[model samples]
Target: MSDEHEHQHEMPATHEHQMGSSLSMAVAATLHCLTGCAIGEIAGLMIATAAGLGNGWSVVISIGLSFLFGYSLSTLPLVKVGVAPLAALSVVLAADTLSIAAMEVTDNLVMVLVPGAMNAGLVNVVFWVGMMISLTAAFLVAVPVNRWLLSRGKGHALTHEFHGMAAAESGWRRWLPSLPTGALVSVLIAFMLGGLVVSIADEAGWQHSSSAAATTRPAQDNPAALALR
Candidate 1:
């Protein structure tokens, strides 16, 4: 009975280690989502600047593409590991898109509202710094919110189901998936896209335009003329 009690005691320590592993996997998954989102968003901004696109259009394109690419980053890995294409695609899209969209909206709002950051041309150090700072701050806020959602098993639940499936499938699987690697690759892709946009915008002579102010008509001092004349 004592030996059985010792064995039971050891089980919890083992479970604790497994729980730690799960936590790491969860974190890696979220970070991957963040990386892909950051890249896609920055690239969108750059493309808008280079193409002389307005803020509205740039933001829309960036959001759409960011979500698409972010989902793809996650889905590709799972699909490669023999997960069903339809299921993998479904989960990644659902899990990462909401989080990415939330981050994008908040972070971009900061960039647009910050003084000297708006349409402020593509090359200003101050503008870039402001955008980066805003994004970082947004990320800090976003992580906990996302983590809370994940704890409920709702945020990353989709992708979580795929972790063990990689080993469950048969030989000659065409894909290899890694949460950490997928995240890194996605970020790199976004950075490259961003750099390209900046270069093109620089070459094409895109510059910030101060919005024109609306003019108001002066109130009629002619009211006196109407009464008298």
Candidate 2:
């Protein structure tokens, strides 16, 4: 055989790696999408605030940016690996967008509906504290749901197909196990619980408008807190 023929014969037809059932892979892929979405949502929220945008606009912009960035982040990783960038991008967009969007709705609605959460002002102790708690909770809920999906290969199927990098070996995967999914679930739970209490308070004629209404307030600087304050 000629040298060209020999070279072609050496490569395997398809690499057989372990991916669980399609359903499992689908779940994992969906979770990876959520991971991207959560990161984007939080980043957008921070960026909008840092820019001194108001609440309603900030959330709208943040959620919008979050979706874009989330999709890009998810796609880029797969592209950087061996997959065709276009195909990888398509798969990620297809698998994760809706699911993450649903989660975002659940997440942001809870934040906005939490009585005076939006209007607590940047300096309002309750508002700032509540945001921190909310972001933390979002992270907490996302991680395990992500990991469980990841383990089964459903959440990240498109990502898993690429040879550019190993999913489980990447920085994202490395940090996942120790992270806080519980805290987010708890915070959301608390928000619901507090809502019930607030409803009761209202029903009993003990309810009053919260001192803080949800407003899109500008941010102020705190050297000690860095951009965080």
Candidate 3:
């Protein structure tokens, strides 16, 4: 066989990589979406929990804010770069709606399913622990969805073209620093983890306090101590 013929006979198994071929890219997009979702979810749940709202209202409020913040975060960058407000919003709605929906559904389900999580007040350890758990679950659920959409040149892929739009813009928007989506995502992730640590510490301290009480209780006041005797 000629070299040219051999070269032309590339295997069918070989395929070109697509936009979402990078797992890290998908992760970054998901994290970007998650930053907004977490803010809305946590805020809604915190408000609902504090106000003693029912689970239904809590889910409704959270879902509403999830879309609100998700669209706002995605839209603001475009608007700052001189895309018209309505146009920016239209693009964002198309770009982030599905991702937010997937995240919100998964997130709300976790909060609803976890025992006493909904009723747990903002100050309660259960609430913060639950917040961490819900966001983690939502993140896991959304990554795959974003990856699927990106592979087809949809989802966050739509926004990729606008990445550097701010570079050429000059005006009042210049005074408004570009919002760093990745930095914001990192902050939200750290907050969730911090809450998790606090919840764990709170739980451990309560357990230790209970154990200490049991160990040091006066014999006469302790039914268990009397029984052992």
Q: Write the per-residue lDDT of candidate 2 for residues 1-229, one digit (tens) a residue.
A: 6988876765443222333344344444444445555556556666666787778776887678768856776666565444566887788776556556665666677678777866544334445455545554555555545545555554554355464454455644344332233453455457545645554555455323332222212332335555664
Q: RMSDs, each prediction?
A: 11.6, 17.0, 4.3
The candidate scoring highest on lDDT is 3
Encode model 3's per-residue lDDT on 102-153: one tens digit a residue.
Answer: 9988988888888888887665677877777888899899998988888888
Cα distance off (Å), candidate 1, residue 83: 2.1
- lDDT by residue for model 1 (1-229), tens: 9999999999999999866765665566556776766667767877888999988988787777777667877887777767787988877766776677667777778877788765766565555666667667666656665666676776677676677764535555453555576648566657555755675566455332221211212223446655765
User: What TM-scores do the predictions have?
Assistant: 0.63, 0.47, 0.78
Model 1 CA lDDT for position 110: 83
Candidate 2, which segments miss by more than 4 Å at Cα?
A: 1-31, 50-52, 121-125, 132-155, 163-229
Clashes of 2: 23
Best by TM-score: 3
lDDT, candidate 2, residue 216?
A: 19
Ranking by TM-score: 3, 1, 2
Better of 1 and 3 by lDDT: 3
> Ten residues in a row with the worst lDDT in model 2?
211-220
Error of 1 at 18 (Å): 11
